[model samples]
Target: MPALKSVTDATFVDEVLLAAGPVLVDFWAPWCRPCRAVSPVVEQFAARNRGKITVVKLNADENRETTGTYGVKTIPTLMLFRSCREVSSIVGAPSRKALEAKLREML
Candidate 1:
């Protein structure tokens, strides 16, 4: 199963921005309760939709520059990128059903 990949400021450009398929970047922090709450859904989606898109997690605490650049002011923000540009986003912890709905519209 494809797993959720961890990203940092150093690799954000190449890993998410320049990626071929749509990249879902989950901006979160280790200490954020809501961030932890949504992690399982993100992981399952990552494995199930492995070929459809790229799922990555960026720890806002460790990757301050990238988080600031992306305008991620909230924890558990999920941003979708295509062709090096951001196309859509989800802020806060959402239900798996809700997240799936958003993914459908974006994908």
Candidate 2:
């Protein structure tokens, strides 16, 4: 299984922006219920798409620069990036199927 990597403002650029494949970044905070609720889906997606995509989790509370750069005003925001460019985003708690479908489309 592909484990989810924790990303901070310091590593965001190298981990997500410069990655070779599509990146699914989950912008969340520990205190957020919705963020926690959607975490499993993100993890499963990561494991399933292991070789095809890179999955990262960014704590919005701790990563101010990253949260600000992405203009993420909401918790549990999911951004899909390819070649360092954001291609799609799903806000709120999306199901595993929905997220997988999006990743499939990107792949």
Candidate 3:
């Protein structure tokens, strides 16, 4: 299974913006219960779409710049970035299947 890569404020541009395929940025905080609930679903999506899409996790508490710039007011927001631009997002804990369905629309 493909693992989730951690991204920091410093590496956000290089990791997400520069990526060729769609990048799913999981903006989450460690203390968020909903974020913890969504973690596994994000991981499974990463593994399933290993080559087609790149999944990266950013801790909102640690990486304030990227999180704040994106206007993420929620802890478990999943933003879909394509060609260095924001395409769409889901802002809560969602089942793996549901997440994948919405992500497929982005792809």
- Candidate 1 positional error at 96, Å: 3.1
Model 1: lDDT equals 0.87
Q: Which ten residues in a row have the lowest lDDT in candidate 3?
A: 98-107
lDDT string, candidate 1, 1-107, tens digits: 55478989999999999898899999988899989888888887778777998889999989899988888898889999999899899999877788777767766
Model 1 spans > 4 angstroms off: 1-3
TM-scores of all models?
0.91, 0.88, 0.90
Best of the two (2, 3) by lDDT? 3
Model 2 regions lying over 4 Å from their true place = 1-3, 95-97
Q: How far is candidate 1 from the true structure (C-alpha RMSD, Å)?
A: 1.4
Candidate 2 weakest ten by summed lDDT: 98-107
lDDT of 3 at 71: 98
What's the distance in Å from true for residue 53, model 1? 0.3
Global Cα RMSD, each model: 1.4, 1.7, 1.5
Candidate 2: residue 40 Cα off by (Å): 0.9
Q: Write the per-residue lDDT of candidate 2 for residues 1-107, one digit (tens) a residue.
A: 55578999999889999999888899998899988888877787678777988889998999999899889998889889888889889888767678667657766
lDDT values for all models: 0.87, 0.85, 0.87
